[model samples]
Target chain A: MRIAELSRRSATSIPSIKYYLREGLIPGGRTTGRNQADYDEAHVRRLRLIRALVDVGGLSIAAVRDVLAAVDNPDLPGHDLLGIAHHAVSPTPARRDPDDPRWQAAREEVVTLIGERGWLVSPCSPALDVAADAIAAMRALDQADLLSSLPTYVEAVERMAAWEVAAVLARGEPARMVEGLVTGTILGEILIGALRRLAQEAESARLQGLTAPE
Target chain B: MRIAELSRRSATSIPSIKYYLREGLIPGGRTTGRNQADYDEAHVRRLRLIRALVDVGGLSIAAVRDVLAAVDNPDLPGHDLLGIAHHAVSPTPARRDPDDPRWQAAREEVVTLIGERGWLVSPCSPALDVAADAIAAMRALDQADLLSSLPTYVEAVERMAAWEVAAVLARGEPARMVEGLVTGTILGEILIGALRRLAQEAESARLQGLTAPE
Candidate 1:
């Protein structure tokens, strides 16, 4: 296969495929002749993965690079590879002034939630910051009741996360496991986010009598 | 209170506040004199809401505007208000070629999931498109197991969405109810996403024996 076929099969534009190749997001194809190259199945798979990350998972180019690097390093432990991918896709922590009481309170609440749930996350985990940022925003907006339901959200997420980790580990291939974890983590968010909204519409319709209850 | 005071109280920079004002994201304060305006507590609150939506909720400026317009329309029913907010913040649907079999299959799967769940969403809901996009991406990346777990995710999200609708409606005041739903829907995503990542870390650690189980 050539670059044109790779682009067509991967559903990516030729220019975008060239860009990914130039940026080393995908390994270079074999040199077939002067100013010509031949791509293979590996290139097609990598291109699809890159598109999935950028288009569906909303990951930045740099984040995709980091995740791909982890994917390429089969010697890395599964857990470490997952950690690198998670860190790359995690939201940037919101800035908070030291004197901001709401942020301080929210940060403390995040720590408490982690402790109460017995989650074995590090104190410095970026997820903690992301959680606190959300809490602080809720408090600032006078919508703290949203946070009051944190336990329910945590219960659902914990169960799903556990299942996800087990599923990826069950693959038994280090490279494939890492790829599963990365795609599952990022694309999984999109899936859940969309499902939640659909559920909200259904629930709202039921409440409004727009649709009868099941 | 003046623009300076609004900026200080909202913890937003003067230029940013001015930008919001210019963008009409926030209503103008009363013009009290030449080149001077008197902002009140409402302005302060609105600024905070804008910041929460933009910074923590990761909503675009256009999304923030749509949500704010919904907030201002207290006459709108709670469900309708929520619908507007949800539509605004929903992820833009990924493009799919009409001839793509994977996408067509994913679309049918999404519809089936909704039907099995007995969800009352419309056929044209953008959430459906978002879900299908995720499924298609998962299939393209050869991580279809992620979509296989869609049932579990849908069950959890449905429960949470029901609780959220009830919580918001219990607020009594239409304005407050709408505000609660908007904040909960948007900020709740951030909170859940962060919690999910934290839970994943914990699960990963336990699997790797990095932390002792309780």
Candidate 2:
């Protein structure tokens, strides 16, 4: 196969594939002539992954590069691969106001929730900061009563994570497992957020006696 | 209360409060003596909501204004309010290539899922497009097998939205109910995303026999 075939197969543009090769986002094809290089199935696969991260996951090229590096790391344990991929795709946490009483209260709430659930989250996990920041913001806005549903939320996501991990693990091969984990984690968040919005709309309509969509 | 009191009560700075007033994100206070005006608890409340949307929800000032409009629409039924607020805060949907067969397949899958679940989602809901786009992206990346878990994901979010709607409705007042919906919808998405990340990490570590954090 050639770059053109790879492009057609991956649904990526040829110039974009060239740019990825120049940027080391994907390995170069084997040289066959002065002006031609022969690509293979691996090139096609890598191009697709890069496109997915950029177009769907909205990751920057550098972040996609980093995610690819993690994906290619043969020695990286499966457990740690998720953390790296998550950090690559997750939003940068907002600047923290450590002295804000509301922030302190929110952090305490998150720590307490994790403890009660007996989950094995690292004390310094960035997700902890992300969760606490959202909590602190909610508290600042005087939405404390809404936080009462924290237990319900926890239970829901717990079930979701279980199913997600089990599904990914079912892929068997270590390479597929890691790819599944990254794709599942990033794309899965978008899927869940979108689905939740639809469900909320339906639930609101049901409670308000609105007619279903035709 | 005056501007300074509004600042202190809402945890927003005086300049920010002035900016909000200038932007009409909040209503003007009653004018008093030269360079003086009287603010009140409503001012404080609006300021907090503005900050939450801007800071935590990552909404632009214009989006925040639109959300505020939906929030203040007394005649708008609660069912319609969710749609407006969701559209206001959601990411602009990408340009669609209607002829793309993969996208068409993904859209059909979504419509079928909605019908099977008997969810009253509007056919024109932006969320339907969002869900379909995500699914199409997954398919393009050769991760279609992951779609098998869609039922589990849908079920989990159904439970979450049910609890969330019930919690918001319990607030009683129409104003409070609308406020709860907006806050819950925006901030709740953040909370759920963060919690899901944390849960994935915990699940990954548990399955790998990794030790819990002290």
Candidate 3:
């Protein structure tokens, strides 16, 4: 296949495919002549993965590069690969003042949630700080009562996470499993976020006795 | 209280409060003397809300203003108020070509899911498209098998959304309820995302026989 067919098959633009090649996000194609190259199924898959990370997952180009590097490293353990993918996708919380009492309290609350769930998470996972940051925001905003929902949220996500891990591991092939990890990590968030909003809308309508639009 | 006091209480800068005032995101303080104004506790709360929406919620200034307008409206129904807030906070998916079969298939899948769940969501809710966009991406990436998780995701979110709506309604005052709705909707996403990552880490560790860090 030529670059044109690669772009068409991958649903990516020609310019983007070229840009990705230049950025080393995707490998170069076999050059057969001047300004001519032949792409293969691998290129198509790579382009799609890159676009998924950027478009659906909302990862930065640099983050995408880092995630792809992790996926490409054959020596990296599966668990470590997931860590890199997660770190790349997770938000970099604005540094908080360590002495802020609310922050400290929220951090403890997050740790307690983990303990109660019997989740074997690393103490240093950036997600710890990210979750604490949100909890702190809830406290700062004086919505402390909403914290009660944390247990439900934790329980729900625990099951979902297990299902996700099983699905990724089921892929068998290393490359396929890594692709699944990146896609599941990023797109799963989008899926959850959007579905939550839809459910919220439905719930609100139910509470208000409002009918669906015609 | 003066602007300084308002700033200190809200943990926002004077310049930011001024910007909020200038942008009409918050109300003007009572003019006291030359270059001096008396700001009340309301000012502090409003500033905090503005910062929460901007910094934590990642809402654009214009969107924040629109959301504030909805919040400040005296006659808006609770359901309508929630509708506006959800729309404001939701991502505007890049417009899809309607004729694309994959996009069409994904959109119908979303509609079918809503029907299967008996959710009374408005047809025009942007979340419908947002969710559809994510599904389309999955199909495009050839990871359609992941779509099987939709039922689980939908069920979990339905329960969570019910709790969210109930919590917001329990706030009593319209203003407080609106505040709860916005805070819960936005921060809830951050909370869920981060928590999901933490859970995935724990699940991955369990699956790979990896030990928690010492």
Candidate 4:
């Protein structure tokens, strides 16, 4: 089909389609004449997938390419796609300030940790790293805030990490890892609902002068 | 005795103190002598409060300034720093795209609905409006990757919205809002863990050829 037809069908623009082809994000269509080219189902599917990952999932072009390549490779597990999707959809990591020593230290740790996990973290997320660094730097001045509440915050992150680790370990279907990751995304929201309600009940109890831990 | 003393006492560096002053993030120090400025107990307390909101509470400098101003104004809720803090620390709303008609439509609905529900959503979140618009644009795509998954995504965002609402209702002290917002920020992560575990169990039971659901 023509570029405009494909664009309307795929929800991508004509120029974007040409760019994707040029970038090899999608394969070039067969040349039928000087200006005409033929695109098939594969091209359509690929374009749609690209849009979903980039436009919907907020993945960068590079990340989408890497993920699609993995998805197309038969040897790759579906879990890899989930990992990429998670990386894309997760909060953009804090950036690191170039002059900040604390940012430098945190960057090293985050890079090491993410690499060791063998997950597809974006190399471009220096912003999230620096944001975290700014956060860390502020702690020294605001020790009161950290000291007063950090045990709770740490406890919370730790609990979440434990829950994640535990969930990853529980498997059955050969695609358990894939299911686990997808389910994790969905169930994560539900658990927040549960926690919020629980916390609210605890707080209301405390406000009414009821005796129980809030 | 001077800015340096206040700095030493608060664990803030002289540079950060200066930055805060220059940015008008924190109030200026009272003049002492030819080359110094003096601050007292109130300054110390106010600075501590500012640090708490910016650091642990994760508010931007502008947002922090606005909230602090509200705290000082008699026309606002004088005793409800905690509730005010909730708005201060809420994530920057998603951006809306001006070029996209579908997105513009979605944001209009979001604005009307938020007002109808009486939620004090900020009108300044052009970014959030765009994001919500982008998400709406994706929904309009009608492809499987997006269309099939949107119900779940909406479920997730709605769940997040519920957490926001519940956290406000659940607080005994105003500080709970900060704690709850921080806690809720990771609520998605928590849900991810729980859902993975639960889905795995369900799948495992099926693999074991267990009893069918009634």
Candidate 5:
């Protein structure tokens, strides 16, 4: 296969493919002639993964690069690879004032939630920051009731996370396991976010006594 | 109160507050004199809401404008206001080819999931598209098993959505209800995503027989 076929198969523009190649997001194809290059199945797969991460997962180019590097590194432990991928995919939160009362309260709530759930998360995990930031945002907006159902949400995510870790660990190949973890971590968020919206709509309709129009 | 006060109180920079005013994402304060305007408590609250939506919710400026307009409209029903907010905050997905077998299959899966859960979502809901697009992405990445836990995730979100809707309805004022819904819908996703990651970390550590470093 050539670059043209790669573009056609991946549904990516030729210019975009070239840009990705230049950015080293996708490896260079084999040089078959002075200007012609031959791509293979690996290129196709790589292109698709890049598209999935960027287009659907909303990862930045730099983040994508880091995630790919983690995926390609054979020496990186599976859990550590997941950590890198997680850090890459999640946006860096704006720094919160450590002394703000709302932030302090939210941080305490997060710590309490962890203790109550008995989750073995590190105190330094970025996820705690993400959750606490959200909690502070809710408080600023005066919508504290949103956090009232924290326990239920925790239960739900615990079960899903257990399943995800098991699925990732079940893969025999380290490379495949890393790839699966990356994809699952990023795409799973998209899937869950979308599903939650749909559920809200459905629940809204039911509460309003509205039927889905056929 | 002036622009500086609004900025100081909201913890946003003067230039950013001016930018928001120029962009009409926030209503201008009353013009009391030349090169001066008197902002009030309402302005402070609105600025906070805008920051929460943009900073935490990751909504675009245009989406924020639309959501604010929906919130300001007095005649819009509370539920309808929420609908508008949901539509605005969620990015419009790139159109997928209807003929793509994977997309078609994913669409069917979305419909089937809704039906299985007895959800009352309309066929035209944008959330259906969002969910289907995510499913297609998962399939493209060859991580289709990620969707296998869809049932559990659905159960969780359904309960959360119900709680969210009930909380919104509990607000007596229409404006307050709309604000609460918008904040919950957007910030709630951030909170859940963070919590899910934290849960994954905990589960991974437990499964791997590792303890979090103190």
Candidate 6:
């Protein structure tokens, strides 16, 4: 079938299909000279996987590439896949210098704290470190311990890991799992969207109550 | 106090402090020229906010910067913070060719889908589009539609939000909302993780029972 057919069958557009092809994220079909090319079931399957990781999983092109690479490689471990997802969700960028001592200090504190947890995280991203530094300065203003946030974070990470594992299992089969994941991911964003509003509402009320005069 | 002294006081580090200084994410502190500088409380508060946005909010620096900028602008509406956070999670790199048809179609599809949902999303990031495309492909192979998963996600997101909101309200002040967000995010992750494992168990039992009858 042609790209247009694949797009139509897949419920995607021809242009979008071409973009995937250009990115080499999707394999190309056999060229038939002029304006025609042929695709098969494999193309359909690949296109779907590409969409799942990118759209639902919220990964970058590079990140999606790594994930696809792993999924295609039979020897890859499940742990690596999860790690890839985690990395995809938390892609890092370059960093810059801090403006004050306190900002600088916060970076060190978080890195040390995260390190002490023995999670084997890569060196804190330069950007994160910079963010931490700015936070350090902020910490100076109020009297809060930098380490006070740790126990809660640990508890959270554990809970998250459990959730992902359970969600995927509900999928039944790998293909179904991908479907479930894809469905879950988009819905997950909406859920977050609604919840954020909910949280804000409650928080706003609490803030007013707490700060009100007796 | 000097950088080292502030570092000791905050339980943070020196290199991190310097890194933050360079990033321009934080403001400059008092300088004594040659080898002297002063630090204070304001720096501390900033540090905490920075750390919360990065570690807990999972925002990148560029996203964080936009947020900080908006937050600093008293004229800017506060309700938009969540929207910013939402955009922060999208991938950033742009790699599509100017004439890519498939890319354009997929991009339009995603933007339209998100908009139709009444979600106030940021401009489409091409890099994110590619990743989402991969997931889209994978989801096409699944058994369910996007709407099917909403119920589970809605319940989970709301539950977490309730717990988090309750926690903040009980704290006597709404300042811990960042903490509230963190708790909610972590709980969601954990919930997903638990569900993943439980599903696998359920499947195994069902499969075993079905096969045993034969």
DockQ of each: 0.61, 0.69, 0.68, 0.09, 0.59, 0.07
Model 5, residue A198: distance off in Å is: 1.7
Judging by TM-score against the true structure, name the best candidate.
2
Select the stronger candidate by TM-score from 1 and 2. Answer: 2
Arrange candidates by TM-score, descending. 2, 3, 1, 5, 4, 6
Tens digits of per-residue lDDT for model 4 on A1-214? 8777788787788999999988889888889999899887677767776776665555677876776666566665444444444544555344435577765664565455434433233455422353344334434333223223222332343334344434543442223333334334433333333333333333333443444223
Candidate 5 on B129-213: residue-level lDDT in tens?
Answer: 7788878877877788766778888888888888878888888665566667677877788788899998888887788787756
Where in model 1 is the C-alpha error above 4 Å?
Answer: A1-69, A91-95, A98-101, A212-214, B1-76, B91-101, B212-214
lDDT of 1 by residue, B84-125 (tens): 767766666547664788877888898888888888887778
Poorest 10 consecutive residues by lDDT, candidate 5 chain A: A172-181
Alpha carbon deviation, residue A106, candidate 2 (Å): 2.4
lDDT for each residue of candidate 1 in A61-164, tens digit (9 for 90 to 100)? 88888888878886888888878777766667546564787777888888887889888887768888878888887887778776667888989998888788
lDDT leader: 3
Q: CA shift at A7, candidate 1, in angstroms?
A: 4.7
Badly placed stretches (over 4 Å) of model 6 are A30-38, A54-63, A93-160, A169-190, A203-214, B1-214
Per-candidate Cα lDDT values, in order, are 0.80, 0.80, 0.83, 0.49, 0.80, 0.49
The CAPRI-style docking tier of model 2 reads medium
RMSD in order of candidates: 4.3, 2.8, 3.1, 9.8, 4.5, 11.0
Using TM-score as the measure, name the better of candidate 4 and candidate 6.
Answer: 4
What is the lDDT for A85 in model 2? Answer: 68
Error of 5 at A3 (Å): 6.7
TM-score of every prediction relative to native:
0.80, 0.89, 0.87, 0.55, 0.79, 0.45
